[model samples]
Target: MRHFRISFLVTFILMAVSGWWGYSHGGMPGLINALWITGVLGVMEVSLSFDNAVVNASVLRHWNEFWQKLFLTVGILVAVFGMRLLFPLVIVSVATGLGLVDVWTMATTTPDVYAKHLTDNHAQVAAFGGAFLLLVFLNFLFDDEKELHWLGWAEEKVNALGTESLAVLITMGAVAACVAMGPVEEKYSVLASGIVGIAVYIGVNWISGLLEEGEPDLQDDEEEGAAPAKNGNGDLVKTVARGSIGGFLYLEVLDASFSFDGVIGAFAITNDVVIIMLGLAIGAMFVRSMTVFLVHKGTLDEFVYLEHGAHYAIGILALIMLASVKYHIPEWFTGLSGVAFILVSLWSSLRYRKRHAAQA
Candidate 1:
């Protein structure tokens, strides 16, 4: 109860600050709309990002107090800057060869037109992102470890390009090339953007795995750094340690991957970039909070298969993204469908818990 109160107060403060800022710039009506839009976007983002929380909890459980703070503090900055500011710019740069300042002007001035143009061409983006996520989802289904042979193969072939960092750098270069030459040189090559997105995802995962191996094992230092105290039997208490900052960052990257479609799709409904950001940011915040809530409460243990459902949702979303790359499904339809899947999965979790309790 105490935690929940603090969470609500924090959320309120942040939203209020955002409202004041928006109001100062755009007047009362603008502030109200910003509140309403960001509010709505926040709800949608939470729902859409539920799976993200589940995934994050799994990774964050291992982190120590220091890195955990860093995860929240630094992670928030990364999300705001990387997703809110730079991401849209990246999309614009890829779509049109415009400078960042010019893109910002266009995004703010004629946001509706910018949104519509992006929405109109969403199929390609969806297809690419969808395909990549699908591959990730399928890999989870088939392989337990989810290793990236691509990077490993590169390590063998090219001495300099073999490093994990180099692999990602090169992959980004390829993505830029694909975005540039692939579409312009050959009209059919527009599909290359999503391919690049997939390649990037792979690179990121490989890099994360490589970096995660560097962290000290938690069990080794558990005696010196146990959590505050356990209320009940130790079974329910998670051993806290500084886990992988890289792991959480990787999760954020995946969350961004999931966001690509939603961000573009949101534009189809309305063109206000501010509205889009407001809504999406709000949604993302809720999701992040929910993730922390679940972690703190050990909700995953309560609902054993909740994580599975989320991964499945990720799979479905990935497919939707891929389809969007080439097709024109209604934006609302994509969001609602994922929502439905998650609901069904949640229900299953409840049922599973009930059955187990009855047997016990």
Candidate 2:
């Protein structure tokens, strides 16, 4: 109870301070929308990211208290500011003639134009994001540890590049060329980008395996009181092997991935870049903090199927991304689906506890 209280108060203080700062810098309308936008987006993000904490908990069990704190403080910065702050601006600036600062101004001042631009590109954005997420969701269907033999045909095609660096560079060139040819076709860009994302995932996994196989094992540190660290040829595998970063990184990566859609989507909601940033930043921060709380408190362990629920939420988000490109789904539906999932996961946990208590 004491730990829970401390975590809750700490989160409240941080949110309050950030909210006040955003309001002061932005105008009253900006402030008002920021509050509403932040509330809605925050709840949505946190609910969707519950699986992130569950995965983080599994990996975090290896870390000492210091690393845990680092994961909270530094990791949050990486997730919030790096992903939510910098990435969207980078995407918009590169995609559109607008700089992030200008986008911010437009979001606050000339929201309609900003929105129009985003709407213009929504389909391409949706296709790219939708396809990428589709691959991600499909990955869980296969045995994650399986080698790429099943994808042998794809492997041969990808390997024809001779080197991973070349493959990535070639992919980038292709995307750039498509963007440059004016009147960017939504179908083409979406398909290419989607395939590229899947290729990158597979390529990286393959490369990591080869590298790990060549390494020598590290001496066990009895002091650590954790599993033996994997040392390859005296090089410590400092990170988890084979997609082991857990739901946190998945959520973080997907959150950033989702940002392209979100920032693009936000333009439609309101142009006030200040409102967009404040709303989204607050939302991102809250989600990150919520992930931390879930990990620290063992909420997922308490709720056995919560992780599965979050994955389902991701699937929904992916579908929304694809659907938004063409048809309009009510925002209420997007927001409510996530909320409902979280509530159900929570209910499952409570029920489990009650049943266990009665049996005991």
Question: Candidate 2, residues 163-246: lDDT per residue as tens digits?
Answer: 544434544443344334324456576656656665645554566466456434434444556566356732224433322344
Alpha-carbon shift of residue 25 in model 1 (angstroms): 7.2
Per-candidate local distance difference test: 0.62, 0.56
RMSD of each: 9.1, 8.5
Predict model 2's lDDT versus the native: 0.56
For all predicted structures, in order, the TM-scores are 0.73, 0.65
Model 1 lDDT per residue over 141-187, tens place: 44424332222454234443344445345434433443443335432
User: How many Å off is the CA of 40 in candidate 1?
Assistant: 1.8
The TM-score that candidate 1 achieves is 0.73
Which sections of candidate 1 miss by over 4 Å? 1-31, 120-124, 143-191, 215-242
Candidate 2, residue 212: Cα displacement in angstroms equals: 5.7
